[model samples]
Target: MKKFKVSLLQLDVKFGDPEANYSNVEKYIEEAVQDKPDVLVLPEMWNTGYDLERLETIADKDGQRTKTLLTRLAKHFAVNIVGGSVATKEDGKFYNTSYIFDRKGQLISQYQKVHLFGLMSEDDFISAGSTLNQFIIDGIKAAGVICYDIRFPEWERKLMSTGQQILFVSAQWPTKRIEQWKMLLCARAIENQSFVVAVNRVGNAPKDSFNGHSLVIDPLGKILEEGATDVEGIFTCEFDLDDLKAVRGNIPVFDDRRTDLYF
Candidate 1:
């Protein structure tokens, strides 16, 4: 079906505490599934909130715990899951990673955050990812990226070029720059002529306090649903992929791209 429902779990993550976060995440997922959304998304760094220094110790080893938890939940609910960015360790190196699981609990895709936020000291502890995140979920072409990746349009363009109808962004954006977060999301949706579902965490970390303005935007840059600032709740919205044809046909942005003249 072209029509699909998406839900964002705008949760408050506890810093450096994977066990508590795990319990909280499970509770949130149970709450979110009540909406019966086809796809459920979580915020960036949900497992460990910018606990950069302790990443070597706190990061999920091989993402085994996260994978198992999300997989079981996905299968139980019969829902697709975008297990938002988590701090993971592989081969003794840490990375901000995201996992996607299909309804049957099959792992469809995994992406390490390509653009590490140097300002947050992410580069010092977490390794950067080099690959793009593109996949299909619930019969719809979609892509997922972490927090800081939203600032880079070219990277998003590359993913959308594949004709993905939905772009899922998992972020832990701070209150200081929340406006930019909203603007950039809408801009990406308008530019790509694709749906944008962004989930940001709320509450405070050691240094930064996040404002959850989780949003669901249409191809036309219209807000389908938006969460209250700093509220921890599930925000659900429904839209049809069939609408993309009319939107893209009218603008023809992708078709008219002059790739040869641009970088």
Candidate 2:
């Protein structure tokens, strides 16, 4: 079986502080690279942690800065990157956006969060993405989505419909709803019969607390790696494409779907 190693960097993000957060992320990435994982993952809002009010001034200008840095890192290390979501500024509007890069440092896909957490006033500060995200890395079909987007099974279904075998989620989920975060991730993996690699931030914002439970789950809804709360750590896992195929074949949920009669 062919296996790929993935590293998830679960770190605490300083609220409203991009410089400090960037330095922190850089340090973690350096540490994660020592293991020579095929892909490096980061948590959500790593650039400017939930500082909605200051996003206009603090957000990455069209994500150029993040792309440049990630691209350079990917090329230098010769590894793929699931660059976490950032507060992105474009056309005078802000958005929660994610970027992915290939081992050769090629930009593959970028996803802007579609579902804005109205409870957090995300609707007020960010522009929602209008398209479904699907991309390829090393000939593997993959999809990228933001935090709140995970609640909508239809979105994950759409990605699965496109033959996505791996789902990458980046979130700044609150500690109060940590259980939902974990359950939903497992559900997505089980329902879609795909690998789920989710990275959530740790630490507290002005009004909310985040408990990092970043996890990598296999197709059978088994956790391969999980992170601890209030700490910085690298959780690594090796996934086999053959194993995913075997699990899906055993269950065959996708083949058993009755889509036309449902909706």
Candidate 3:
């Protein structure tokens, strides 16, 4: 299908509490399935919100549990899931990771957050990822990234240049800079000529308060749907791959790039 619907979970995470978060996740996922969107997106660190010190204690072990839950949900609901970023532990180290499950519940993509936000002390607790994640869902090419990656346009362009039509970002952005979150997502969509689907969490953690400003933006920079700050719910939007082609064809941003001049 050239056009499809997506539902975002503007969910809330309990700091250092995976059990509570899991229940919340289940409730939201069940509710989101009611909309029967082709894809479901969620926030970064939804499993444990910025509970850095508790990484070793609370992180998902090798992401097995995360995969199991997402897989079952995707299969049962018949929906693709940009499963969002979660704290995961592997080989005695922790990483912020994002997982994607196809409609069949097959794990399609796994992206560990490459950029660790120094301001949040992420650099101290989590190991950085060195790879990019790009995959196809129902024949549509897409990419997934964590919260801080939005500030780096080159990363988004890297995927868009390689035929990615949709960009999914999952975040646990604090309340202080929610405006920047909205602006950046719109800018990414407009600049890349692709649909940007960003899901953010709401409520508070130990050190920060999250504002749920999850959004879906079209290639022309239009805010298709947005969630309210500090509210928990599902926000859904629909878009067509044809729109990406139209935007790219009209501006030719990629075709007109001066690759030879960049430092």
User: How does each model score on lDDT?
Assistant: 0.93, 0.89, 0.90
Put the candidates in lDDT order, highest first.
Answer: 1, 3, 2
Model 3, poorest ten-residue lDDT window? 238-247
RMSD of 3: 1.2
Clashes of 3: 0
Instruction: Give residue 167's lDDT in candidate 3 (0 to 100).
Output: 93
After TM-score superposition, what is the CA distance of residue 104 in candidate 1 from its true location, in Å?
0.4
In the range 32-116, model 2's lDDT, one tens digit per residue, is 9999898998988899888899887899998998998899989999999999889999888898999999998899888889999
Ranking by TM-score: 1, 3, 2
Q: How far is candidate 1 from the true structure (C-alpha RMSD, Å)?
A: 1.0
Q: What tens digits encode model 3's per-residue C-alpha lDDT throughout 1-263?
A: 37789999999899899999988898899999998799999899989888999888899999988899999999999899999988999999999999999999999889999989998999999999989989999899888889999999998888788788899999988899989998999999988888989998999877789889899899989998989878899998887778777678889988888989951
Over the stretch 129-244, how does candidate 1's per-residue lDDT look in tens digits?
Answer: 99888999866889988989999999999999978999999999999999999999999999999999999999999999999999999999999999998899898999888999
Please give the lDDT score for candidate 2: 0.89
Error of 3 at 252 (Å): 1.0
